[model samples]
Target: MSVSGHLATITSAEENAFIFDSVANGNNAWFGLSDAETEGTFTWVTGELLDYTNWFTGEPNNDAILGEDFGEFKADGFWNDLPSAAKASYLVEYSTSVPTPPGIMLLMIALTCLILQRKRIIFKTE
Candidate 1:
């Protein structure tokens, strides 16, 4: 699925295992799947296709006292249900299409002009 600029939408078993291996810090984490809109209908925050899942057995049970709508992809390559307010580490997916901020873009252009001018002077002296 074409996911960008949002929380990770892990779409394959290989990716899931890789992520778990990278972050096996023994801490619960949230991957931003929630059924806040409709019960039992978990969707990624980025709206990417729900093509894969690693749910821990009997989990996403929505069994929390307040309700378990949020998803916590644990360190053990399994997913569990939690509430949105629960504390955990989060993963974000950045998009290359996200444009540079105007200020940064301007700074880059100015730097490029200065470098070119320096090169021209060096070449003339040689």
Candidate 2:
């Protein structure tokens, strides 16, 4: 997975294991075959196709012109089910889990340096 132009490619079994755990427990359904039970039509979070026919009766009937249109993906070109255009959230799961970004490591390194530097200051003050 990537964030703010940084990429973290998941290329290991341990990482995939974590992704599976996250998706299994996460509230948002971002990965794996839909429990509705079908194969080969595996819908991706990044994909535009939503199975409207499988929607619950009266579902996916969202109005197109009302500006609250989230179900118009079946007929209208409007963005559906995704958050607003300005949002930068990531879908962290699929059939397998994705990777956390490298920036988190950088942040940890910076925090560690700051903490160690504080220790140096205390030593000098004492």
Expressed as tens digits, the lDDT of each residue in 1-126 for candidate 1 is 333566667889997887787754666777768898878888988787897888999887997577889888887879988877778887666666556889999999999999999999999999
Q: Compute each candidate's TM-score over C-alphas.
A: 0.67, 0.23
- Total backbone clashes of model 1? 0
**Which segments of model 1 are wrong by more than 4 Å?**
1-4, 98-126
**Highest lDDT among the candidates is held by which one?**
1
Worst 10 residues of 1 by lDDT: 1-10
The sequence of per-residue lDDT tens digits that candidate 2 reaches over residues 22-86 is 53243222222121222223243344354432233454333334333221121221123322232
Query: Top model by TM-score, which number?
Result: 1
